[model samples]
Target: MKVCLVGSSGGHLTHLYMLKPFWKEKDRFWVTFEKEDARSLLEGEKMYPCYFPTNRNIKNLIRNTFVAWKVLRKEKPDLIISSGAAVSVPFFYLGKLLGAKLIYIEVFDRIDKPTLSGKMVYPIVDKFIVQWEEEKKVYPKAVNLGSIF
Candidate 1:
């Protein structure tokens, strides 16, 4: 299966990386920030750099959405997964629209609250995974996977 793993750098990326066992053998590529850690950790893996300043930057969000649309069109992945920040919003929606199975993993750090990106994509995703049980209360449809760490 062709998988497109999308996430921001840092913790979000870390969580996504923890699923290497599942994705390592799959036909996969990443969409993430161009950070030193990301470059180092993902060395030898296929990747596409996403736009920065995605928290609330309307301009970059629009730009990234367009980029995501184009990439999704070309890659035509069967599945798209992410442990997210704001950068994931566009890809989640676009991937769903393009008939890709969308999986959103709630960041491991958020125990008591839902992330903005999680809330945005929850209703649309095929699977919503949360690391902590408390998060399940916030995202009732989410499955508690007991942490990816």
Candidate 2:
């Protein structure tokens, strides 16, 4: 199955990298904000750029929508997965619009609280997965899969 993994750099990319072994031979596409770590770790994969900000920026959101549109058209992935920090929000929406299963893995950092991106995308995702049981209280529907690591 085709998979599109989207997220910000750092812990989000770390989570997706753990799933890489299970994705052998699948048409896998990765989308993340450019970072030194992701660049070194995910070299040569079909990747896209997303601007991730510490704070919400309206201009970046508009640009991200257009970027997602182009990628969704090209990839048409069967599944879209993310360990998010806002960068994946557009791609997850694209996955839904294109009728692909969307899985949102809550960031490992938010072991106690739901992330802003997680809260925004949770209700629409096919699977809402959290690494911590405490988070399950906030998102009753989430699958407690331990740390995606």
Candidate 3:
């Protein structure tokens, strides 16, 4: 099935890269901010660049929304799997509205705690995959699928 992996750099991208090989046999794409990390790991697939967030705060959400609007209209993948930051937020909303299955993998960083985005998107996700079992305490509905990597 066609899939889009949406996430930021650093840990999020690191984790998603681990699952890249599996998606290669099918139509797969990656969406990220302005960063070379995804480019270095992925080859010959579609990619969308969301405006990089400078503060890692709400301000970037607006910019990402615009980027998401463009991507969803073009790619319109059957499913969206994200190990996220700001970029995935817009995609999640768009995916839900567009009737696409949205699977969100809470980043591996919050091994002991949870992130703001994780908390917000937890209940909305069609399938919430968490790297750590402890994450389920915060989001009881999440499936503690041992890391995709």
Candidate 4:
């Protein structure tokens, strides 16, 4: 399957990278920030860098959305999976609109409260996975996948 892995930099990217074993062999590419960690970890891999200042930044969000539209149109991934921050928002909607299955993994750190990205994409995703069981209270439809760490 053609897969598009989307996530922000730092911890969000780290958590998604843990699932490398799952996507490494598949036809996959990444949508993430161009950070040192992302650069090092994704060396030689196909990736589409996202814009910065994502959280609540309307300017960047609009720019990122345009970028996402282009990428999703060109890649035509069969599935789009994300452990997100802010960059995944545009990709999720565009990917879904293009008929790609959407899977969202809530960040492992947010146990008590739901993340904004998670909540925003929750109702639209095909699958909502949570690392912690307690997260289910916030995202009732989320499946407890017992941590991606």
What C-alpha lDDT values do all the predictions have? 0.92, 0.84, 0.78, 0.92
Each prediction's TM-score versus the true structure: 0.98, 0.93, 0.90, 0.97
Per-residue lDDT of model 3, residues 20-110, tens digit only: 5777687877887657766776656677767776236667788788778888888888898877776787888888888789888887768
**Candidate 2 on 57-96: residue-level lDDT in tens?**
7787778888889998988899998888777788888779
RMSD of candidates 1 onward, in order: 0.7, 1.3, 1.7, 0.8
Give the C-alpha miss distance for residue 133 in model 4, angstroms. Answer: 1.0
Clashes of 2: 0
**lDDT tens digits, residues 1-149, model 1?**
99999999988888889999999999999999999999999999999999997998999899899989989999999999998898899998988889999999998889999899999999899999998999989999989989787
Candidate 3 C-alpha RMSD relative to the actual structure = 1.7
For candidate 1, the clash count comes to 0
lDDT agreement of model 1 with the native = 0.92
Clashing pairs in 2: none
Stretches of model 2 off by over 4 angstroms after superposition = none
How many steric clashes between backbone atoms does each model show?
A: 0, 0, 0, 0
lDDT by residue (48-110, candidate 4, tens digit) is 998997999999999999999999999999999999988999999988999999999998889
